[model samples]
Target: MKRLFYSSAIYTALGLLSGLFYREMSRANNFDGYSQLNVTHTHMLVLGTIMFLVFMLVEKNFSLTRHQKLFNWFFVTYHIGLLLTVAMQMTNGIMTIKGIEVSPAIAGMSGLGHIFLTVAFILFYILLNKSAFKNKK
Candidate 1:
């Protein structure tokens, strides 16, 4: 529960900062075109902060740590996925604002990050089901 709450808090900070970054960077460059950074703030808040808040609640009700391995896997994979996706977005946004040519490889990597997040999401549901079905200790 503590870990989950801390993760949510950290993500809350990251989300706010990312939004500020997007606003300031675009303004500094006088950017008017759409960029992935436009959505980075939302992605961080939803995926990072909100997801973890829900996780903490799930933990309180279902004792997610009962299945420690699955919980750990879900936690690590989720972080990797979110960070990779957001990093790519920020990189692409910066490149766009600076008039640099964006590479296809970044998109490919971002897709991979989405894959990780999908897998993590599945693992999380599985964990939830497992805990919910378990007998009280």
Candidate 2:
């Protein structure tokens, strides 16, 4: 139940952030626009928060094989990825507002963050599927 509560909180926060970020980007009025903020935000919400919680529920209801530790690692890595991506994006937005070009460093961070998340998702899938369809009786 506690896991569900935290997961719900993450989802709610993710939705709020998505709406707010979308509004900011729409208002920016950048005509040359194909920003990854929307994509990144969606990935964070779907993979980082939603998937993590789903795994938490599976962990709660299943008999796992040392998978608990891996799930914790997934949680850490996923959040780290999200934090890096979001910080880079928010910083880029600030720079855009200040009339400064986006920094290559931030771009690199966002890219690496994406990779971390990809790996995290793979691990999450492996952990969840290992016991998701097992016979209960």
Candidate 3:
């Protein structure tokens, strides 16, 4: 939870910075570059920060695995998806900053990230169920 609070704080700060610099960015030679930056900001905050907080809460409230295996798997998949998503998004932002269009690689990685995120969520749900059962026993 403390980690999450810090993450949220940083995310809010980034949002503020993005907003404050918007006008300046728009008037610059790289005006079009602002769009991808905004997008990456949203992606990082929404998934990397918010979703990670939710994952932490779930893990803390429920000791879902007898061993660390399931917990580690969940964390790994979640971070992999989150990192890939953010990286592709940042790459796309860089292209935008250079006035280039988004590439197919970005599109493909985004799709894969979505799939992995879904799978991660499913794993979390399964872990929660298992934990609940264990508690009952």
TM-score preference between candidates 1 and 2, better one? 1
lDDT of 3: 0.67
Across residues 27-95, which tens digit of lDDT does each residue of candidate 2 receive? 776524555555556665765567657765666777444566776677667777767777677677556
TM for every model, in the order presented, reads 0.95, 0.66, 0.71
lDDT of 1 by residue, 19-125 (tens): 99999999999998999889999999999999999999989999998899999999999999999999999999899989999999999989999999999999999
Model 3 misses residue 134 by how many Å? 2.2
Q: What number of clashing residue pairs does each candidate have, in the order they appear?
A: 0, 0, 0
| Per-residue C-alpha lDDT of model 3 across residues 90-135, encoded as one tens digit per residue | 6776567667788797879977988888888888787778886774
Error of 2 at 128 (Å): 2.2
> Which ranges of candidate 1 are over 4 A from the true structure?
none
Worst 10 residues of 3 by lDDT: 17-26
Residue 9 C-alpha lDDT in model 1: 95
Q: Which residue pairs show backbone clashes in model 3? A: none
Instruction: Please report how far candidate 1 places residue 91 from its true position, in Å.
Output: 0.7
Question: What's the true lDDT of residue 109 in model 1?
Answer: 89
